[model samples]
Target: MTSPHDDPPRRPPVISSPRRAAVSAAAVTAVLVLACAALASAGGPADRRDPTADPAPEAVATSAPLDVAADRLTDQTGLAVTIDALSPAALEPGNRLRLSGQVTNVGRGSWRDAQVYLDIAYDPVTTKGALDDANSSDEPFGTRIVEFGLFDRIGAVPPGTTTSYRLDVPYAELPLSGAAGVHRVGVTVLVTNRDGERVEAARADTVMPLVAASDPTPPPAEVVIVVPVTAPIARHQSGNFLDERIAGAISAGGRLRNLVDLIEAVPPDTLEIVVDPALLDAVQDMSDGYAVTTRQEEADQGSGRNGTGQVEAEEWLADFQTVTARQNLLLMAWGSPDASALASQRMPGVVAAAVRASDEFAVDSGLITPTVSWQKNGASTRRGLVVSRIAGAVIQFVAADNLVNLRAQGESAYLPSLVTVPTEEGELTGVVTARELAGQRLTMSTSVLDFRQNLMAEATIRSLEAASAPSPMVVALPFGWNPGDAAEVDVATAFDLATVEPVDLKAVTQSTPAAYPGPIRLTPAQSPLSDELTDAIVRLRTNGNTFTSLLTDNADAAAFDRRLAVSATSLWLGQPQERLALIRMESRAAAEQLRKVTVTGPTFVALSSRSGRFPLTITNGLQESVTLRVDVRAQNPALRIDPIAELVLEPGQSRDIEVTTRSDSSGLTPVRVRLSTVDGKVFGAPWEFDVRATQIGVAIWVVMGAGSVILVGTVAFRLVRRIRTEGLHPREEPNP
Candidate 1:
C-alpha cells in the first residue's frame, strides 16, 4: 500500500536532540573500549613484557709482591767474604743493591788524618783481561775493582767517637751464576779502616731469596745504577762543611748539581735514579767506552792596570789535546758455545785486534799519558751479549783563553770595578750569557747590567776593529753596570793575529787622574754603572730614510718591536660631498673584492653584490653626535638589503659590525651576519642568525584555516538536527 505514489505521507526521518546525540556517542565509545579490552586479553604475558639482552662476563684476580727490602749485612776483611742471607731480601739480575756497614776506629789515639778504602766487586771473576799491549799482566781482581775512599780529618772522632762509616754497594757485584735456581745470592763485605792497615774481622754470609721470575726472558738492557756519593738528599754534605761548599761552587747548576737537586726534591724513600730514555742512552754510553771526548782548562797568566783605565790584561790561549784510553771491546758468541773453546780461539784474536787499534789511535792523536784497563761485568743467556765499558785515563787539557776577563777572576780584588773588554758590539763591561765557546771564537749575550752598559758593543767593536790599530775607544757608562757582567765580543780580527799585544800603561801623576776607587760591591737595588761600558743603541732618527722605514715598519720585526695605528675614512656620503664621494667610491670598489677588516668599537660592513664582501671601518672625530647616510641599492636578482643597524656606544666604546644578504627569487636564501668581540678583549661575543624558510609559515596558516572550517560546519549541522528533533518530540520522554 506504501509503494503507491504517496501512501499516508511518510513520517519525517527521526532526528535526535542534543541530549540524545550525546548519549549515542557515549554508547559507541563504550562498545569500542570493551572490544579493545577483549583483544588485549588474548595476547600472552611474554608478548607484553619488555625485552632484555645478554649478561656480561665476570672478572678474575691475581697477586704480586709489594716491596723489596735489604734485610741483613756482614763485614769481611782480607779473605773474600760472602753474604748468605739478607733480610726482607729480594735480589734479582738487573736489580741493583745499596749496602751500608759502619767502620769504627777502635784505636785509643784518634786516627789523625786517616782514610778508609773499600772496593766494590761485580760478578765472581776479578782480573779479567789486559787492555794495554805494553802491560802483559793487569791488576789483580780486588786491585782493579772500583774503590770508594773516605777521608777523616776535621772534627776527628774523639778517642771514643767511634767513627761509623756507611757504604753503598751494588747487587751486580755479588756472585749470581750459582744462584740461578735459588732465590738468594752470596755477598762479600770487605773493610779496611786504615788504608793497608790490618783488615777487620771478616764475615761471609748469604741472603734469603727476595725475587723470583715468572718468565725466563733476560732484562731488556744493562743499567748503570749510580748511588749518591753521600746520603739521600744530601750530596757531599756528609763531608766537612768546607768540602761541601767547594763542591757546590764547582758544580752549581751543572748536570751533577741538577741531578742532586732533583733527588733532594723527591721523597727520601725513592733511592733509584730513573733516567729518561734519551738521558739513559747517554749515561750508558758514558758508562761504556765513550770517554768525555772534549776537554779544556783555564789558566790565569798575568794582569796589570793600564794608566787611568781599569785593570788591563795580556794575551790568553787554549791548547788542543786528547787523552788515550782503551777502545771499547765487544765479544759475542752463541749461548750454547763452549766457553773454553771460544775464549781460547775467538776471544784472544779479538782482543789482539782491539789492542792494536787502541794503541794506534792513541799514538796518532798524540795522547802521551795513555793508560788502559779492561772490564767484563756482563753475560747473556740469549744468543749473546756485547761487552762495552770505558778503559782509559782522563787527559787534562790546558784552557788558557780569556783568563783576565773570567768571571771567577773578576770576583777577586785583583780585578777592578770597571774592566774594558772587546765585545761584538764594541768594548763593554759586566756579565754575559755564554752562547758559544770554541777555539778562539766565543759568543755571549749581555746580562741585565751589561745590556744597559754596552747595548751597542757589537757594532762598536766592529767599528774599532776597522779603525787603524785598535785605539783607546771611549766607553760610556749606562744606567746599570756590574763587574763580571758579559757582553758579546767579536774576535775575528784577532783570530788572524796569532797573539794579542799586552797593553802598555801611560805614566801619570797622582793628581793627573782622580784616585781610582776600589771595586764597589753592588747592592740588590743600586748598580755601579761602570764607565768602561759600551752602550749599543741604533738611533732610528739618525738612520737612513730607507733603512729607518724598513726597520720601523709595522710588519717588519727585529729582536723587539712595538706599534700603534689610527685610521679614519668615510664610506657613507654626507656634507663633505667630494670627500664622501671619494671614500664611497673607494669603499664600493673594495666591496667588489673580498674585504675583511677587523675593528675595535663600532664598525659597519655593507655589500650589495654576488661573490663579494665589503668591510667598512668608520672613525668618529666629532665632539658631539655624528650621523652619516649609507646608501644600499638592489644589484642582481630579487635582492634584499637590510636597514643600517645602530650601535649605541659611549664615545670610547668599540664593537664589531655585521652585514647580511638575501635573495627572494627562488629556493631558500642563506645569509650570515657575524658580530664578535675583537679578540674577546671586550664584552659581547660573536653570533650568527638562523633564519627559517618563508614557506613554513604559509603551511601553518593553511592548517589553521582547515581546522576553523571543520569546527563551524560541525556546530551548524548539530544545531540544525537538534532543532528538527526537538520540533518532532514536543514532550520530553521518560528518563531511562
Candidate 2:
C-alpha cells in the first residue's frame, strides 16, 4: 500500500530493453501524422506557411441533399466533379475569389476531350437552419451570380485520373451585379470534342463568402484553444491494459504523440489539461519490468513471470509526468467512467473508482483532481449524485457559469471567471468544456462549418474589443479529435489574430468565484449508450468483494485494473455494443477467478466418540493470498463445532483447519463449512457434509442413571399412598 504521506513520486524500477521488433508501416505512418500535426499546431513564422499546401477552405455551413450522389452526373464514360477545398471562406467586398479544385474521370475508359466551366451563384438565406433546407432541396435556387466565358478551355482527363483547374474571377465580373448574402461556388465538368459540348458530367457546390453589398466581417476578438490529451486503451478489471498495444503504438509513433505535442504547445500559465489516468495507469502498469499482450491468446496465458517483458514499456510516463506538472484536472477519466450513466444509475463502485483513481494519480503525482474539474458531457445531471462514500469531494464544471449557486435555479449571471464551490466530496467547480461551435475540427467539411467559423470569429472579435477583455477565454479541446485532420496552423492563426492566448483549464477553474446569485445553466447531456454502461456496471457489483480482495494484493490488483481499463468512456464512446460485450466478459472472468477459493476437505465426518475434532482443507487458486475464517453450521445441537481458526493462504496454496464438535445425543446431522473474510463476507460456495454420531458421552449415561433412581423412588411413594387411601377404594369397588 502506498503511504498517504509519501510526498515524493516513486520511479519504477529500471529494466533492460527488449529486442526491437520490426516497426510496421502503419506504425510509421501514424507517427508521421502525429508529428506533422504537432508541428502544425505550434505557431511558426508567417513565411513558413504554404498558402497552397493545404488549401482546403474552413468547413462550409450548408446541408446537402439526402442523395448526395445526385450532385454528380456522368454519360457513357463516368466522370466526377468535386471541390476538394476553397480558400478564404470569409472574404471582404470586391475581393477576387480564386477558387481551385479537381475534376475526375471515374469511368473505366478515358475521356479524349473535355472542357470545364466555372459557375457562381448566391443564396439569400444565411442562417444555418435556412441554409440546410436550401442545401438539401432537390431543386436548385434560381439566383445566378456569374456565367463566365473566360476559363472554358479544352482538356483531356484520363480514366482514373483527375484534372485540376483554377478560376480567378474579380468582383466586377459578377452577373449578380451587386447582390450578396452567401455565394455557392461550384464547378461544371464537360465531356466533348471540338464538335460541341452539352452534357455536364459533374456539378458540386460549396459555400464561400460573397458579401458584396456589405463590408467584410472582421475575425473574432478572442479565440480559445482547447486540445484533448487522451489515448485508446482497453482495460482488465484487474487494473491492467488488455495488452501491450498502447505501449507498442506509442513507443514508435502513434496518435498519442499528437497529445504529447498538444501538452507541450499549451501555454503554461493557463493550460487546461483533461487527463484520463487510465492511459497513464496503463503506462505505469507496463513499466513494472512487465506487460500483458493485446493478443487474446497471449493474455490468456496470464501475466509473465515477474522479470518478464521488462523491456516493453514506453516510459511515456516521464513526459506525462512533466506535462502534469502544469495546471490540470482529472476528467472523471480514471477509467473514462460513464459519469452521466453511473451517476444516474447510482452505481456504488463507479464513484469510488473515480475517487480512488484520482487519489492514486493526483496524490502520488502531487496534482489536482478537484471535484469541480469533472467534464461531464451533458446537461441532464443538474445536481450531484448520491454515490457511496468514495468521492470524498466531487467538483463539477457546469457549462454556463464560473460559479453556480449550487442551490439557485433562476437565470444565470456570467461572472469574470472560475466558480469553485466547496463540498464534502471536493469542490463543485463550474467551468465549461468547449461548446460544439467553440471547440471542434476547425476545418471540417460539413454543414456546421459556418456556425463554427462564427464562434471563432466572435471570440477573436470580442478579445480585440478591449485590451483587458476576457483575454484568456477558456475552451476544452474536444476529446477523440482526429489528429490527422487537425488544422493546427489555421486555428493558431485565428487565435493569434483575435489576440487569443492558450490558458490552462485549471488556472481558469481555480480562479476565485464571483458573487453570481443567479442560476447556472448547463448543456444538456446526451449519453445515448448510458443504459448499456449502467447495466454493465450493475453486473460488476456481484464481483466487487472479490475484486476488492484482489486489489489488496500486488499481482492480483495489477491484473484486475488492466481488465477494467476498457471501460474508459473515450475508448468505448461509439462502440456501446462492443463495450457491453467486453464488460460482460470481464465480469465473467472476475467471477471465475473469485470462485477458485474452494474447500477441498472430506464430504463426510464420522464420529465414534461424542467429542472429537475434524480436519478440513481449503485451497486458494488465485495469485494473491487470502486471510479468511472457516464458518461451521450444523442442524443438530448434538453436533457442536467451534468456528475454526482464521487461516491465511498464499497464492495457489492450501491449508488444513481443525474444528472440535461435542454432542449429548446425535444420529446424523447435516453440516456446512464455508470460507469468509475475517469481516464475514462469504467466499465462493459452502461445503455441505453429513456428521454421524455413534456413542453418547459419559455425562449422558450419568444423567440417565440418576433419572432412573428418581423414577423408582416416586413410584414406590405413590404406591404406598394408594394402598393406604386411594388403593383401598379400588379393592372395595371390586368387592361390591
Candidate 3:
C-alpha cells in the first residue's frame, strides 16, 4: 500500500514461455520508444542545445497548434511597437529586411515572454484603391512568419516600460512570392498574456516595394514633380521686412533652407520649383540691410530694429542662385497671389498686374521664363482658368478632384495627368496632380523608407495599369513642405527609381492630352479671398498707382505693383486679420508717401496793386527727385493767377515759386494751389488759401495823372512870373 502523495513500486520483468517472452519484449520496446519521444519533444538537454538557433523542423511539427481567437488576433494589446528604421528601404533580391524599433508596454499589465515577428501579406496591392486601403486601414491583414527563428525574443516588458527590438530576415524567407509590386509588411508582438496564452498583442504595418531585376523594363513614365518654394508674407510696402522670421527660414536648418538642400540633392533638371519672386526680393533686401518692425504701426513710422541675418541672407541667396542656376525655375506671381481668389472676385487687373510683376522678376533675376501657373491648393474655377490664360500662362496645374469626366477605366487604371482646357484667350494645358499621392502629406513623422516605398508602389501600379505604356504623371508637392533631415533623402530617392523618368514641365505640356468621356468640367474655387479683402486689395492698387505716378521714372512703379501683389497672396487666405492689417499698413504707407510731396503757403496773401507777385513754396520730401506741375486758381472771377508749367525739385528739396497775380477788382478772393504729375494726374491733396488784392483802379490813376500835369503847367507859369517880377532876385542868388 502507498500513501496518496507517494510513488508506487515497480515489479521486475519475468520471462515465462516463448510466446510470453515475445509479448514482454514488445511491451518493453514500446515503453522505451515513448520515453525517447518525450525527451526529443522537450528539446533534450537544454544545456547542450543552442538557444539562439532554430529548432529542427520536426520539433515545430510536434508542438501544439497555435490557440488564438481569429477575431482577436489583431486586437490592441499592452505593448505599443514603433519601427524607427527599415534597412534596405526597397526590397531587392539577395537582401535581408532588417527592422529596429522600440516596444513599450502602455497597458496596466506587464507583457511576459515577448517576441516580435515579421508579418507580411504575400499578395501585392495592384490597384490604387487597394493601396490606399492598405495604407489607411487600422486592422491591417498579415500572416506571421514564425519559422526559421526569424523573430526577436525580448524577455519581458513591465507596465509603462520600453525595450528595444531588432528583427532581420532574409528576403527569400519572407512569406511573399509571385508579384513584384508593393506588398504589406509589418511587425507583430507575441506575448504571454495573464491567461498564459501566446497571442498577438500589438502590431505596426508599412509598405515594402520590390523591383526585380529580371522584369522587362517598360517605357519609363514621364514624371513632373512641382516643388513650391515659398514663405509667409513678411514684406512691407516700403521694401522693408515686417519681421525677422524669414531670416530664420532661410538659415541652415530652416524650412526654406531644407528646400534648397533638396533641390541641390536632386538632379538639376528633375524638379520644377515654383518660386515666389517676392520672397527672393525680400531676401535680397535683407542681404543688403533691412529693418524689421516690432509693431505693424512702426512699419510706416520708420521706427524698427535692423535685421541680424545679413550674413545668412547673403549666403543663402548665393547658394540659391547657384543651385537654381541649372534647375528649371517656374516663377510664381511676384507675391504668389491667390489667382483663383482674385478671379472669383472679378479682379482680373490685380491678377494681370501680379503676372506682369512675376515676368519682370524672372527677367531681372535671370531665371527661366515662367510658362506654367499654379493656384494655391491646386484649386481653380473656370474664370480662373481664363484669367490665367490671359496672364500668359500656357499651362495650369490643378487638383485632380476639381475636375469632372476625368475618371479612369477602373480603380487600378491610371488617371490622366494632363488635359486641355478651353478659355477665352486660348487653350491651356492642364497638369493634374495625382490626388492619391498628394493626399499623403509628407511630414517628419513619415519615415524615408516608407515614403519611398509608397511612391514606388504608386509608380508601379500606374505603369501596370497602362500595360507598361508610357504614361505622363505630375506630382505637386504641398506648399511650404518641409522635408526634415530624415526625409530629405526620401524626396531625392523617390525620383531616382528606374521606372521614373524625370521631365521638365515643358515636356508634360507637350505630351498628348488624355481624352475625357464628355465635355470637361471644372469645380468652383474651394476657398477664395473674401469680398472685404478683395475690395481692400482694389483700394490698395488704386492708391498704389496714384502714389507711383509721382515717380519721375516709370520703372519705379514696378516696385509698387509687386508690393500690391504681396497684399493679395494666397498666404492670406485664412488669415483675415493679418491680411487686413497688412493691407491697411500698405495703404497707409502709400498715403504717407503721397503726402510727402506737397505745396504750402500762407493762408492769406495781400497784393497792394494789380499785377503783383506772391510767393508759394513747393517741397519734395521723397528720396528721389521729382518733376511736378503747379496749377493755381482763384475762386473770384475778378482775380487772375499764372500757372507753373513744370517744376523740378531735388530730393528733400523745398523752393518757393513766385506767382504773378492780376485783380480786376479789390476784395478778398479764395485761391487754390495743387501739385500734379507731368502727365497732369493729381499727385497729392490740394493747398487752398485766400488772396486779398488792394489794387489801384484805372479811374483813380487817370485823375492823379491829370492833376499832376495841371500842377506842373501852373508851376511853369508861376516860375515865368516870378522870373519877370524878381529879375532883381539874381543878386540874391549870388548871396546864396
Candidate 4:
C-alpha cells in the first residue's frame, strides 16, 4: 500500500512542450495584468509594499532572501512543514476535502507570531501511460488557474517541535475546471511572517479524477467484479512453508486483510472471489511454525535457521475461513499455476496433481466453484486475454473471492476503471486499474478522488444505455505486489453509486454466447525441469506401482507427489528463473526422501550344494512401516530362485530375508532382485549378486543314470522280438 503522500512534490518540466510554451507565454501576459490590478487594490498579497530599498520589509521580516519569495521559499526561516494525509474518499462536487499534514519548527530563530498556510492548485490528466512514462506533467493546463490558500490558519510554533493540522476545505471553493477526466492537484505548506511574505516548506501532489454531480436516478448497471486472492508461488522447503509473501498477505493490514474488508462490505453474492489452492496449502502449513528456504549457497540450509524468519500461523487461517465463507469461493489450480507455463512432459502428471489438490481443498473447506476463466498476468486486459490448449478444459479449472486490491498485473499501466471483456463464454468483467492509480498508495483525498472517478464512470455507462445501447461495466480491483493501508476506504467505496451483484464467470460462460473471443493468443515459453526433478517425479509414480489403485491406497507417496506438482505449478510464470531453481531444489529433496527404502545384501554368494538359500536386508528409511516383497530373477540359466511373498518392514528398522536358489551346472551365475510393492512393481533401485556354482548336484546325476538305463533296456527289448520291428517301422513316414 503506497501512499500518494509518500511521493515527493513532482517538479514541473524544465522545457515546456510547444503547446505548453504557448500557454506559458500567455500566462505570463495574464499574470502581469492581474499583478498590476492587485497592486492598485487596497489589500492584497503585495498590498502596501515598503518602497524603501534598505532592509526590504517582506524579505527581512521573514529573515530570508527576497528572490525566493515567489517560487520555492525554503525554511531558512526555522520551520519545516509536511502533509501527512488527506481524507473522505467520497470527494464529489460540492463536498468538503480534508488534508492532513505536519509542520515543525527546527531553527527556533523566530520570536514573534508564525502561521502555516496551504497552496492547492489543480492539474488535469494528460495521458494514460502507467508509471515510468512521461504520461503525466504537473503543468497547469489552464494558466488562468491560480494557486489559492485553503483553510489557512494563523498560529505560533515553539523551536524544535512539530505540530499536526487538518485542513477541511469545501470542494466547490477550489479552482476546478469541473471536467470529467483525471485531474492532478498539488499541495504544499508555507510559513508566513507578519510582513505578508510566505516561504514554502514541504509539498506533495495528488493525481485523481473528480466525479461530476450524480444524476437523480442512474440506470441500473450489470457489473461483475472479480477479486484475486493469490500469493507468490511457493514450495515448503524441508517440510516448512517458505514463501514469506503469502504469510504477510494473510497478516493484519496485509493484502488479505484489506481484501477481506472490501469483500465484507459487499453482499455475499455481490462479487465472486477466486482463490489459489497453493496458497491454501501453504497457509495450512503455517498453522504451526514452519521453515522457509533461506540461503541457496548454504550446503545444508534445510529450510530452518533456528527460527530466524519462520512464520508460525497465528489467526490467518481462522480469519480466512471466516471471511471467505461470507462470499462465493472459486478454486484456482494448485499454486494458481499458469496452464501455458507447464512443461510439455510434466503436463499430464501436473494436471492430475493440481486437480487432486483442488478436490482435497474442497473436502476441507466444503466449498467449490467451476474454474471457467482464470486471470493470467499480461493476458488479462480490457482488449486481449490469454487462453490455453482447448478453451473447454480451461473453463473447468478455476471457478469462484472479495477484497479488491487496486494492483495491476505485470506492468502498473492499465485502465483502473471497470472493463467488459467479451468472450464466447459471456461478458467477462474486471477492473484494469488505471495506470496512474494502479497499486497507488492513497490517503484520504486521493482515495475519494479515485473513488469519485470510478463512480463517475457510471455516468458514462448510463448515457450509453439511455441511447438504447446497454453495455455492462465489469470492474477488477487494483492489485499490488505489496499493498499497504494507503487507500483502505476507497476499496469499499468502489461500489457506492449503486450496489449490483456481479455475475459469476462460470454461469456467464455457460449461459452467454460470449465464447472466448481470443482475438489474440499467446503460448507460454518452454518450461524446463531438471533431470533430478523429472527422475524424482517418475520414481514417485513408479513407487506407487507396487500398490493397486495408488490414489486410494498410497497416501504417503501420493502426498509427496502432490507437493512436487504444486512446486512445479505455473504460478511461477511471472518468475521463470526462480521457478526453475525451486523445482530443482524440491525435486532433489524428494529424491533424498525416496531413497529411504533401499536394498542391502552381499554382492557375491558361493554355492557348492545343488540347492541353497542366501539372506539379504531391506532397510526402511521412512517414518512409517511398509509391507512389501522382493522380486528376484536369475540372469543365468544355471541358477533358479523361488518366488517371494509379501513381507513387512518396520519404521526405521531393517528386515533380513532369505531366498532359495538351485544350480545344476558348474558355473558362475548372476542374480538380480529389487524391492517390490504388494501389487508386484519394483520399488527402489535394483540389486544384483553373482553366484558361483562349483559342482553338479546329486539330483541331476541320479536322473541321468535312470534315463540311460531305460534307453538301454528299450533297445534290448527291441532286438529280442521282431514285434519290436513295428516300433521301428513307426519311425517311417505314414501313407499320405
lDDT scores in order: 0.23, 0.49, 0.67, 0.47
Query: How big is the positional error of residue 225 in model 4, measured in Å on the Cα after superposition?
Result: 3.4
Per-residue lDDT over 401-507 for candidate 1, one digit per residue giving the tens place of the 0 to 100 score: 21222332312211111233332334322211111111011111111211211112222222222222122111111111111201111212221111112111111
Q: Candidate 4: TM-score?
A: 0.57
Better of 1 and 2 by TM-score: 2
Ten-residue region with minimum lDDT total, candidate 1: 315-324
lDDT of 3 by residue, 1-736 (tens): 1124322122112211100000011122223344344455677532255777643221110000111111133225645565656767667778998887767654446678887777677677666666766665436365566654577778788754668888888888876665767777777777887787777776665676666642775445567777788877666655667666788778766778766777777766887778888788888888998888744457437667788889889999998888887678778766767777777777777777778888887787676677456666576666776777788765677777677667653342566777776666656667877645512444223333445556666676665555633457777766665554434244566666666677887777676686532343345545667788788888788777776777776676887777777788876565687768778777877778888999988788898877788788999999988888899989997898866668888889999988888887889998988888777777677889898988787899999999999999999999999889987455544555
- TM-score of every prediction relative to native: 0.18, 0.59, 0.71, 0.57
* Worst 10 contiguous positions by lDDT, candidate 4: 57-66
Residue 433 displacement in candidate 4 (angstroms):
10
Sort every candidate by lDDT, greatest first. 3, 2, 4, 1
Q: What is the lDDT of residue 287 in candidate 1?
A: 29
- Candidate 2 per-residue lDDT, tens place, 200-228, comes to 55555544433335445433333334544
